[model samples]
Target: MALARRTLTPFGLWVFGAAASAPMVVLAGGIVATYATTRVTALPLTFLLVAGTVAVLAVGYTAMARQLGHPAAYYGILANGLGRGWGVAAGMVALVAYNAIQTSLFGLFGATMAAQLGGAWWVWAGIALAVVGVMGVRAIVLSTRVLAAVLTVSLLIVAAFVLACVGRPAAGGLSWEGFDASGLAVSGIGGAVAFCVAAFMGVDAPGSFVEEAIDRTSVGRATIGGVVVLGGVYALAAWAMGVAVGPGSVAEAAADPAAGLPFAVLERLGGWWVPLAELVLIFAVVTSMLAFHSVVARYVFAMAREGVLPAGLAQTGSAMRVSAPRGGSLTQTGTATVVVGAFALAGADPIGVMFTWLSTLGAMGLLCLLLAASVAAMTAPARVRGPQAGAWEWRLAPALGVLGGSVVLALMVGNVGSLLGAAPGPMYPFFLPAILTATAIVGGVWAGHLRQAKPEVYPGIGRGIPKTHAVPDAINVSI
Candidate 1:
């Protein structure tokens, strides 16, 4: 079955992309943690720098969006520019990365619910899995609506907090300390930047649903819009957090961020909102997982249809020109269930083991994918000649994206132990890189075999279902 065409407007696409970023979680979790690690009054600066870098990346990304009609953006870009071999490698990395991200959230969701409500982590996880499974097998519109509602409520709470901080600063009063350049000159600057960039992890996810967007242009618009909006929200929230806690005490507060920095601030400014904010946070994580699950399901559907995986996995349920990848959704949900169950059965610390290991590993793999995609964006224009591609969009912007992604990758490598909340060790530092390298090698070998034995399938390695089998006009039009 084929995905429905023209089902998502620009707003829907933006909401979908932004939901994947999980603003509430990043604001309350990632930003606060960055202050603790770097001990630098430069949270806002780090966010701005990361935002600018991603915006540069989006220039090429959006440019390429017009040419590559495939839902698997990273894989298609690589295939069109680098080679089908690298495309296969990207596809492998994407499946692993997206699945890791989706599954990792189960730990956060379950643990948070258990702490806030009264239940076991596994029980909450199982319940979440069931809800997500139901949502995942429905039409895209249904999921987007849920994402939109969650995002709207969560962001409203965030906005309220930011306004409160601005209106009532702590002891030091309103200050721009976080944007000060000198404050960024710290020992863990690289790690801080890496963490900041990771906050925008899913900004490009909307490209995966271009085929379902109301207008092809909505894909690029949604991508750029997500980056800008998420970046602004992160930067503003971090700055407000600094204001809420006196600038002098911000670092100390961040040291135990997970202990409830945002809650503490809200309690001080608007005690009544604390309960509401907590509830919003829970829903935010749930929606984020649902959003990421949808992304993973699409990747599996796209890859399976292209013959990279079992054809049965590509099966979808279709009605009224809309299709839901029920098979792919079920496959991903099953994988999450198994992984979560294993962790619970092992009696492991859900937060320490499941969340940390998988999230950090997934972040590393995604950075590698982004790095490869940046390269593809820079080179693909030479061969495909996208609609309005120019030196700025195709060359300079992508060049910057490459540099930025490489720096973040290097930082993540050096600080992997810290990011994983583990003690420094050779084994911990090198494990993720080694796994990624092995996956790349395996994908290359498979692509080579397909090239020699199944030439027809090889050409469509990143393309979705073949045109003959796809619903009419279901594929995106080249801009």
Candidate 2:
């Protein structure tokens, strides 16, 4: 079946991209950790820096999107710009990175929900996996709505918390310390920047839905909008944290991030919404998981259609041609279930094993993907007829993205122990890169085999472009 084209509006794409960021989780959990590590009152500034970097990358990224009109994310850009072999390698990396992210969320969700609702963590994880699976099989519109609603609630809670902080600032009294660079000179600034960058990881997610956007322009707008919104929201919340507890004492206050320090600040500031905010955070994580689920499914579908995976995995829903990747969704769901169940059976600590290790690995892998994509954006073939970005936007911005992403990747690797919330060890630090390298080698070898044995499918590695099929036209924009 042919996929539908132009089924999603700008707002839907924005929500999907932004929700994948899990703003509330970052505000409530990630920021606190950053603060504890960096002891930097200017954590908000770090967020702005990260956002600005991404915005620059988007200038070139969106330009490429307009030119290529492919919806397979990095794989498409890599294939068209770099080569089929590199694109195949990227596809393998993306699948593993996104799946790691999605599965890692279950650990956080299960632990949080179990703490609040009085149940086994595995029970909560299992339930979430099942629910998200169902949602993943539904129309993209449905998932967008769910994400939009949850994101709205989460943002409102953050807004309320910020207001309370501003109303009752600590001894320093709502200073602009967080904006000053001097305040960021902590012992772990590298780790802090890496985490901040991790928090902005989903800025490119909107591009994955370009095939379904109401207009190709919507993809660019949605991506930029999501980046700005997440950046602004995170900055505000982090600033509020600094204000509420006094910048100097932030590290001490957040010494125990697992204790939900940010929400505790809200409670202390006469904000009676702590419990409600916690609930919103749970929903935020769920929405984030669902968003990543959708991203992974699309990758699977795109690869399947290109013959990198089984073609059956590309099957969409019958009711809507551009609807969900039902087969891919089911496949991801089953994989997550088995992984989560195995951890449960082993009586593992959900937070330590599933959340920390997997999420850190995913974050590092994503950084690598972003770096490759930025290079692709700079070198990709441009369209002769369509709108073209200026030289600075197309060239300089992607160059900067490549530089910045490389630095962050290095920092993440050096601070792998801190990122994983564990002591430094040879295995812990080296495992992720080894795995990524191995996958890339496997994918390249596989692509070479396909080129030799099945030349017809080799060139179409990331071409989720338009053609006649059982899918709807709305979801098949040309590559």
Give Cα-based local distance difference scores for all models: 0.80, 0.79
What is the Cα-based TM-score of model 1? 0.94
Residue 176's lDDT in candidate 2: 80
lDDT computed for candidate 2: 0.79
Q: With candidate 1 superimposed using the best TM-score fit, by how many Å does residue 115's alpha carbon deviate from the native?
A: 0.8
Per-residue lDDT of model 2, residues 128-212, tens digit only? 9989998898877677878989988988888888888888888746678888998667667777887887788776788888767
Error at 17, model 1, angstroms: 1.4
Question: Per-residue alpha-carbon lDDT of model 1 for 82-163, expressed as tens digits?
Answer: 8889998888888788888789889998999998887899999999999999889887877888899899998998898898
What's the TM-score of each model vs. the native? 0.94, 0.94
